[model samples]
Target: MKNLFIPHFIYWSLFMTSKENYHKVSILLSIYKVEDYLEECLDSLLNQSYHNLEIVCVDNGSPDNCGKILQKYAKKDSRIKIVTLKENRMLCGGRNAGLDHATGDFVCFVDPDDWVEKDHIKAMVDAILTKKDSLGNPYNLVLNRNAVSFMILADGSLKKMYDFGETSGEKTLNDVNLNVREDTEVPMWGRLYRKSFLDAHPDIRFLEGMNTDNIPYTFKLLAHMKRFYVIKGEENATYWRRLITPEGAITPVVLWKNMEIPICFDNLFDYLKKHHLAKNLRIPYHWFFTICFPRHKDQPRYYLRFKELMKKMEDTVKSSDVYKQEDRNLCDLLLYAPDFFNFMERYFTPVPVRISRSRIKLFGFIPFWYIRHKERKVYYDLFKIPLFKRVKTDDKEILYLFHFLPIWTRQTDRQ
Candidate 1:
């Protein structure tokens, strides 16, 4: 019997030729059970103004009608390429499959539930074609703004846009002011990348796990990237549809693990240290140990692992010329948490603890309170807002007065 699968060399050559001929961006759509929104997503891609485009949609064995939708689009549009997995491969596997089949010089991964603006590809491609790095290579990663808004089917309309402005940038990971924790940095979508950069880092494959498929993969990619472009403007593109369906991948347990919590910091620190990227690792390590840790009291291991991680983090920071007094202060706070040594032992134990709902809710609010009290200046500066920026109008006051006013008066007003 003849083998059905094409050789990798043949595939690569075909892809390269296609890239040379089209000189377009490849949109990688990883579809699972997003049948409810698949058509709309595909429509957005089909309607893109960027003519030289290839849409590679990988269906990871969705039990829903998503496969059928993908097939329909593939049949209708020659540019739409569909790859249906025989078995259910999660997000990471699906994306890898799409990556394997993508043919454009630049690749953008879009969730099946999400749709991009008409100019998404044009913006990114223009930036990549025009912009060059210090080493003369085109910018490896081009980040488009992600507007978080819900698309309501009732009126077939979207709500007001919640602008997450220039969230990803070269300085984002390294900035002292931007205390970006691991959990916040690994979002897989909203960025366009060069195909060659990804090809160079084949080992940067997404982890085929429940929670953290993107963190390890993104970290490895970012470590090697030279130039990162941030596109800024009012051209609102990429509508991230927030589904209310409970059946989606995210769950409370999944969230705990996927948040990359402190464990990711440990893993990333090891990775960076192994690669001798010590200076680059310091800020992220400090943020992970200090900021991301204290927020979760329910994760006993976080508390237990505190002392050792703190020591390592302190040493790493101290050894670096970029280390600051604020970083040291943050470390001190972690070391001083109630029953510091014992907490470290219990919290860092290999075994996981059963987190109560009440504890989860309490732990959830801790970050906000901690930022307000401990790192007030850092928090304000990172958010690019002034502390005690008063509400201007009566309507605005009614909205935010409780956040600023004294507790008694706020309670009385609410009552």
Candidate 2:
């Protein structure tokens, strides 16, 4: 039984007197077998524009040289705190251990393998400190831009970056904001959390040994927030993530846990119900059926397990009173005839096309005009102005408005 201790009281006593540390941000880095990338990750935090950062790295019993690397960094920088464990506790357990020693007013989780921009902490802290929810209370969460995953190719050149975190929208997240997939509903990283708020809700801890922990943790956290703030445009900092390839998507252990998402979701719903929290599950319902299950539905090795677990999750989703009949109907459609649902979702789904003056270019790169039909009328716009007059026909098909770019624009129907 190898034991390691953190002298938290002495450290806090020395730092608490400084007013500059009032808005201190504690970054929790859960280190396991990431020695190769650990130094770069630590360097990124050390170079952060936010000087008031507290970097808490938990060496989760990593057998590699991660412990040595953490110690090396800690000796050079007082802001770096090290927590060691005897064995691997997985991501959630490691972060939980880090949280116990975190003394920052705001907390953020950064993977030891991933690095962030220099201004990431500064951007997050600045927004969270100055902003407040509708009720004039500070938000429990502050979301930054989506993380882009990058990888180095054989030639030492970077591969094309792919964006993760399927969400976007308003500056402040509300009920409607959550309806569309937007940032911070998932992924523990790329966001900032208030330590005091987290302390208030003891039930919000991450479920150890769970691959799908972030989903339920995020959902429950959102319920307590009056609203959360999203940093948009240039002001927001970017989280540069390293692309990770799964060893095997359908490995026995991975498959078993993948199938356990429903159980995790069930446990989440139970917790929500027990505490009487608002149970808006739009994200969870769609994410499970549409995203999680569908990914494994096509793999032959995992199809049977996927179907069985999907049906179980469907039951949990159906029991929730917050969902409407249409939502339940969709869930049934997905479970019974996934092929038909996929076809409909691919072709019949209403995908909004956003057009604005700023997007149009005169060099013919982006079309200066857009045309669509509606009820025997052809609505068209050129450079955001009506160029054609309305034409009526005796017999014509009624079509819905398809193009929406409102900028001093007029609609004219033409036969």
Highest lDDT, which number? 2
Q: Cα RMSD (Å) between model 1 and the true structure?
A: 15.4
Candidate 2 residue 25 Cα shift, in angstroms, is 1.3
What ranges in model 2 sit over 4 Å off?
Answer: 1-19, 153-156, 163-180, 184-186, 246-257, 297-326, 330-415
Residue 94 shift from truth in candidate 2, angstroms: 1.4
Model 1, 1-415: lDDT tens digits are 1344557667867877763455767888777778888898889889887767789888888999998888788888999988889887777788888888987888888777776678777777777778766566678887766446453534555555355555443433454224443224425666788898898877667655334555566666666663476666665355464543434434333343334445555566667677777566344545555445545545556555654566667677667765677676556656665675655664456644432211112455532221232211111112323233122232222222224542221212321
lDDT of 2 by residue, 371-409 (tens): 555443566677666554333455333333333433333
lDDT of 2: 0.67
The C-alpha TM-scores of every prediction are: 0.65, 0.68
TM-score of 1: 0.65
Pick out the ten consecutive residues of candidate 2 with the lowest summed lDDT.
247-256
Runs of candidate 1 with Cα error greater than 4 angstroms are 1-22, 134-137, 151-161, 166-173, 176-186, 235-241, 244-254, 257-259, 282-298, 302-314, 321-415
Q: lDDT at 163 for candidate 1?
A: 53
